[model samples]
Target: MASIRISCLLMGLLTVFLGTEVHSYAASFGSLAHTASATATTTTRSVTTTTRVVRKRTWATQSSNKAFNINMLDMCHRYGYNVDGQFVVPEFMKLLNALNRAQCHMASEILYPRDYCLSIKDEDKVDLIVIGSGTAGSLLAAKLSDNRDLKVLLLEAGNLPLMTSEIPGLWADSIGTEMDWKYFAVADETFGQSLDGKKVNVIRGKCLGGTTAMNNMLYDRGLEKDYLYLESIGLTKWGWKYALKLYKKSEDCKFEKITTSKTVKNFHSQGGKVSVDSFRNTRTLGIRQSFSKAISSSNLKTVDYFDVKNHRGFVSSIAMIKNGLRLNAARAFLTDANRKYNLRVALKSTAKRLLFEDNKVVGVEFENSIGELIKVRVTEGVVLSAGPIGSPQLLLQSGIGPKSLLNSLAIPEVAVNERVGSNLQAHASFLGMIVSFETQPLKAYSISEMVYEYLLKQSGPLANIGLSSFTGFIDVNEDGTPDVQIHFYYYSEDDTVFMPSQLDAFNFNDNITEQIIDINENNDMEIVGISLLHPTNSGNVIIEKTDNGYKPVIKYGSLHEDDVTTLLKAIEWFKKVLTSEAFEKYGPKIVPLKIAGGPEPNVDSEEYWKYAIKHLTTMNVQMAGTCSIALNPSEGVVNQNLKVFGVENLWVADSSVIPRIFSTESSAPTLFVAEKANDIIKNQLGCKGSNESNEDDDENENN
Candidate 1:
């Protein structure tokens, strides 16, 4: 009877121990089986007895193992754990210790037993390979991949957009982060000098969707005359007729009560991939109505910005946003149908250089995600869609630019195109005026409340990009074409609650900051900015050899006298609108301009405005015209067909090939260029279902 009691006591103790172990395991990880089974086998020898206990754990699903394994590998790499193709106990213990130090609780190390450092082999050959999956490249890839007989490979230098990119109002937060190239231009004596005496930051998106992913979602198809000017300069194929068709083909405009004007109904297409709409249906914060009344008081009529026929009045700005989310180029063009079959996308792959065999383009060599060089062979051709600066830099790096530049850089010249990186242009803008209001609409709610509204209903102050609500185009030249674009938006002193880094991102000087602080200490403010649409000055983008790799040297040329003259006229026009009767209701007050270490200028003098222009002028990030199209190599880098001069099977289809700068944002025009390029490439390849005339077929028929 005493022996039986001792056995019962031992069993009770074992049960408590098992319960404690199971509880600890569950607490460290997630939910698991409530009971774990353990079997003990005992063997009695001459002098000793041995027992082996086997424990069984049941996982929720196979996907759980995969998820845990991925997390473990990520944690091991992040914490510097030595994972040399094996999952040993010491290495696992090191990972656990690091996780513990980081205050992270993880499941058992046995869950992730596979090696995570194994190499993956990708497809090496395709009919066509396009480098840089940006605004143009994404659409081009989708169109080219539509033909199942063709295999297309697209490579992007950056990864997919983060969750921050999906939020419409958090665009500025993405800039200068990993998603941006973060290029800085070489300071010019005329317009490049900022208040800090530093070069202006050239923010270019380095992600799959490119700049469209981070830009203020304005959906303006620049002035029609902008395209007509291109045709006048010898690019006859890029006339407004062709551009209009391409714009309609790509846009799916959703008209609502506020957006359904006669001009919008006639111009907007309904069945396209891209969704275009107005934020008035979502959130305008009453700024639209106030601005409309203000402009009207100054005798400026409110017209549709998309009228295409008229661009010289106030209009509600449209955006490339739908359902309160940013409709980026990737979402518009890179559909699942394209990826499911013939299209292959390589993200986080940097194109090192183009591969050539005796002047015939063959393949591309790029650095993959693992930092290993991978070569992708192209059977037909290779298209360079790496934007304005990147496209020129890649061409120069591949020995395809000017002979002199290539010789100086110790790169053998394959093509001597001197204009490969010349003629860079960007719109220059200046803050016209800042007006303080007694009370603002956006200041009514806290940032958390705005975010909550957006999360629940996808509508609120968070849905509006704070750049502008009402835009105005004016013909400073008086030559029938609008040469100045004005953007109007409200700026609450408390807006920093929503975007903490806004003031820093604005790159304001100390004097401007002090003025802003003084104004915000009392009341909210609104700002209006004017951009010179038709600047006569241009710039150039060159490459320099660096210790790490090739770096682009952007030279923004001196601002011309005419550019400043036009801005002066624009500022005068803005003053009239600011003092109109419409602002009387809001009791608007202008914040005086002050310069650091200098006397305050007379507000009405051109001299003072010029000082402000020099200190305040900045690029609106609408850079273009680097690798422009022309009749020959002497005049431009590529011909009207977008084929690189003196090179076969090489093409470029991006904003770089634009012959002239547009009077508005370049996103829509860039998309049009890519669509046109699709036709050009299809015709050249004689692919099935091509609507273009194939020269090869013509030759065959003649033979």
Candidate 2:
């Protein structure tokens, strides 16, 4: 009878103690058992207290052991333990891997002037018009708007930032909503195509923050030579010096508080504006050793490049974060202080066409907040930040494109038919493999009692941006210049590079998206992603079929042999990465990996693979090149300052105007155009930059 009573007590107690998807405070045998006890003995020197002992005992019931093994990301990363920037080190990639996706869904939607700021639009009037509220635009707008007289009109087509945006796991939600300007790429012969040719989607934020709000927030500036290439291609002012200024202007780097390089510590500012560090308590010894071996074997060095101009090494990734949250463009530009003044932010409104008088740009026609059609006449000037895809379409609708294409659309030929909408570029990204292992998910924070800490203490997993970190750079070409860049992001759960039906399943939003994740059911898992930059194949953006208005038709021109080579090279590299010692031992099994020793999946060969990849490959959605720049006005569509040739008071300051494409996030460069173009326009007008222009400024106004 006594034995039976003891067994009943043990059964009742075991049931009471269980670990949840998130940590639970209730005392249970899981932690007091094998794994937890072993970790405790090693981590905690000598046991002191006895009154509240761990209740050490190996339970006969296997249920608790099974539950304890579920989704251990919180426990594994040591989340809910640190304060003032203390965290775990080895599993940083796990955190970064989770950040690979851009989440477009919001728990709740906020209203703005346009459907969302997924695409860029011109706020192009002189000292005021702010183009793109993403990383750079927001900072510029907020700081510039500081001038009392400048009645800034901050425009974004995307939804405002939400509380959930601060949560790292739901990152993919940044891509789909009203904010994403889902531009499709023109189809090519490489990928499997529809009888009706398929275009890969190029998404941009139509919201105030622009892409910065949606991006993973890894701060990477490619090789210095990329800028020099710009000078060779028609952008003389965009050389290093000019580019450096913009970088300085946009960042208030806070390296002291971050777990990164001294160069980053010294070069970047913390107090200036955008909060830039989320890699605290990460960067473990295990991770460092693994990456060092992996990158080194690949013949790459690990060095700090943030402070130096020309750097090479595997440096820790920098971020634009604040208290473990993203400091997006809107946060920088659209401030509460500015909103109090005449700075009006209109959301959900898309600029349709530029209203013109003969050869002069007069104002802009647009669909308002409720999708109402309206016209805003700018007696001063009109700026075009409609990005690469939308801006060109806008110009064409406003009568500014190639004469041949315009004649085909039957739109009245307005601006002298120039080379607008020519050079389109972007990066191609692929999911690697989904890992299901006895591993932690990437949020991997290191704190004691993490869940409760985030819930009440306001310190824990919630305070960390989920990501595994980032790396890769422009590969050296035979000419001794780096030409392409790539990044490998490791996560605890993803399938970035699978087969066709698998690719569709991973890349698109299907019924799987509707199914909520049961974190409790998943543990010992990981995910990997690899991205290829500097795509060679150029595409075209034409006006969609319409008697009036300009809806764009995009083609994913990915047939260039050079692009095929780059994609294949990057894929091969990822295949090699999966075999590294650390991963081979602890990482999930990589099946059918195309590396040296792997079981054969179904198909092989360039022709078969090209067909597979072409149909499989899609743009990272970093779209650019439509209204290209030219040193000689006759050589390109827009002039050096991105002004449409022979047009009066009209300019395009977005990716579309970039004459040549560089390999990095395109938004940063696009914002730089807005920055420099604003100054150039002011100089041309000979006006002291301000919203209310001087009498002399009137002459410079387009009309």
Candidate 3:
């Protein structure tokens, strides 16, 4: 999107030249052409048709002095839509983006310019190389290097789990911090409201544990319907039954019953790496009653969906907690806790590209913390675990992308690719409020109160992260897969001050109890987050420039007609929720949530509602499907084992392998992918089989 302006300029200039040509023809033969008006009209129409090709939306233009390159032309041809032919778009995109560099891969060049290449000593060698330290890569490295068989190298651009605060839902803060990749969205009239009104942030975590450490740790095995849909789409083994088996193999849960339990999302196993527990930290009497009433009124009886055998009852959140501590993928995958004699976890190491020879992945190269260039050889294979943003770019850098794109970056073509970084998927989220005001909860939650409670025994406010657990489901469309999902969270603080409260206000209309005669009261708060899952959106991720070091440019490709319909439905549901009797009992004189943080339903104007919707929606951090893994090598980027389809000894082990979006956070899913992928690699190496690939793609691969 940031590059679209540059592209348009190029298109405009091309069109202008064509415009000049048309004028020249008309001006030169005006008298004769006018006399034979019909003939002139016919000629003009033919010329106009030829000239209109330049007017197509996808074309990219040049900067002040730079001219458009063929690679840019190619990018337009494949990736530029909203533009005409995509043949040129993907290439131009690569020029601006830089296809995924190899591990230790650098911008435009390999860590250094041409002048510096001659200075390097060629004796660098490592026994084993792991491209990423996130889910798949981390697990593979932990297992392969556990025997201290040889020196192992892992390269990662993101920050590691270096601090306590980095834990998920810790302070319920850090959503859009420096650790977030913060990608861009393709311009869309349907969801561009955020872009045009407020500079709302689109988040993707860039820290260690990668996105897993930051995602709301909801453990889901996906619905039966989801797998069925995948089967219909030509993918097997991913069906519900097989997926459930894998879920069972990788998970180890304590099975704590959730309170205020509406949906008991079942978890598997009793001794896995993650700590699955129902955090019964605290809940208010009033809020509890209100929630119960709300469920009964909605006729949505709470059910315990976690009984691997039978799912039917209300239970609490079965979170991935171990001894009250988070066991993220990085932690779980590491077999040895202390310094490894043969393994190296290179934190802050950003992978640039995969080194190849005659179409085989040899190793990876990257930039370390000091900004110094480094290279490591895989000897066997190079797997990409940089998630969606990083993986696709890596493919392009390896010359595995559209042919024309590599040329634009001046990158020599190594492989005239198939669908490497072509199909991308993602889901969008919004921070909205049904109501926001001082609550009886916060007043009692002072910092000193936490200190006092902790000093006595680590069992009070100090021990808890203020996020009240959430509930909802993968409600489906006619196709059976969930299209829309609604999650409700307890915002522990003031909403207006923390969120862009200018969005909805009517949901907070003042209400009164028998004790209080008047109804003009506000303070109790709640945030209702409506998400569009299984979105019909698709965007592209390409390598940009040589050394911006700002990660890749992933164009947000979501909010097609279906996605909007789902989002609108989610909104309608929220409105229904607020209108519930449970809501009425709560002292909000404001019967329902407000919009644009503006006037209550009294505003009644459609324009006001539209503005409110625009300000409230945004991108969530759960991104996947840049390097898809599937049974169909034709439609997928990776094979069943998570290895890249075209390149030998090359694989993508992160969230990128998920062929479509899931109805849940991507962290747990990636960890599962790593878990399963490790075993797959092990079997290939003649080792025993264990664990399994644990996740799903964004919601649209079936489409």
* TM-score of each model, paired residue for residue: 0.79, 0.71, 0.70
Better of 2 and 3 by TM-score: 2
Estimate, for each residue in 1-703, the C-alpha lDDT of model 2 and write its tens digit. 2233323332332332332222322221123322222112210112243322221222222334444342457554543332344454343434323222111111111122222222324443423444345544454455545555555555555555544354443344555555667655555655424211344556666766777666666665555656677787756667665655555555666655433653334334345555555355352335555666877766776554343254444566666665445666565545454344645565665667777888887776666666666555555465666667767877888777778887887878786555676667666654433444455424443222332233232344334433344455535443444444544333322221111112232343221111101111234333344445566667777786755455787765565777667666655665575568756545554432232122344333444445445544556656666777786655667787667787887776766766556566665565566566656665665545433111232211110
For model 2, the superposed segments whose C-alpha errors exceed 4 Å read: 1-24, 27-132, 135-150, 192-199, 257-271, 281-285, 304-313, 336-340, 432-468, 474-484, 489-528, 546-548, 582-584, 593-612, 685-703
- Pick the TM-score winner: 1
Question: How well is each residue in 1-703 modelled by candidate 1, as lDDT tens digits?
Answer: 2223323322332233222222332132223213233343311111122433222221211122332222545434443322243434464455345433322111110010111111324437788988877778988888888888888888888877654565676667677788889887887656534443446778788987888888878878787678778878878777766666677677888756324764445556777877888776334535556667777754557764555666778777788887777778887787563334677887778888888888888888887888888877889999999999999999999998878899999988888888989999888877636778865544354333443355445566667776464678887677877888887555555344322234334555544644554555456776667888867878899999998579999987677888888988888877777677766666776665776544475667788778777767777778888889999889998888889988889999999998778878888888888888988898889888776421222111100
lDDT for model 3, please: 0.51
Error of 3 at 500 (Å): 10
The global C-alpha lDDT for each of the candidates, from Candidate 1 onward, is: 0.68, 0.51, 0.51
Over 1-703, each residue of candidate 3 has an lDDT whose tens digit, in order, gives: 2133323432433332222222222232122211001112111102222211111111111122345344535434333442232234344344333212211121111010011222222335665667655556666677666545455666666664433322233423334455556555554444535333333344555665566555556665444454566677666655655455455455666654432333432324555555566555554435544555665654444554444332222234466654444555666665353456666666677777778887887777776666777676766566677777777887787677766767767776766655667667766664443554333544344222332243233345434443344455534343434555555554343221112211211111111110010111224455556666666767667775746632456566645656655655556555655567666544442233344344455323444445545545666667777787777556778877777766688767887877776666666566657666666665565544443444553422221
**Model 1, runs deviating above 4 Å:** 1-123, 195-197, 257-266, 281-285, 297-299, 337-339, 441-443, 498-500, 693-703
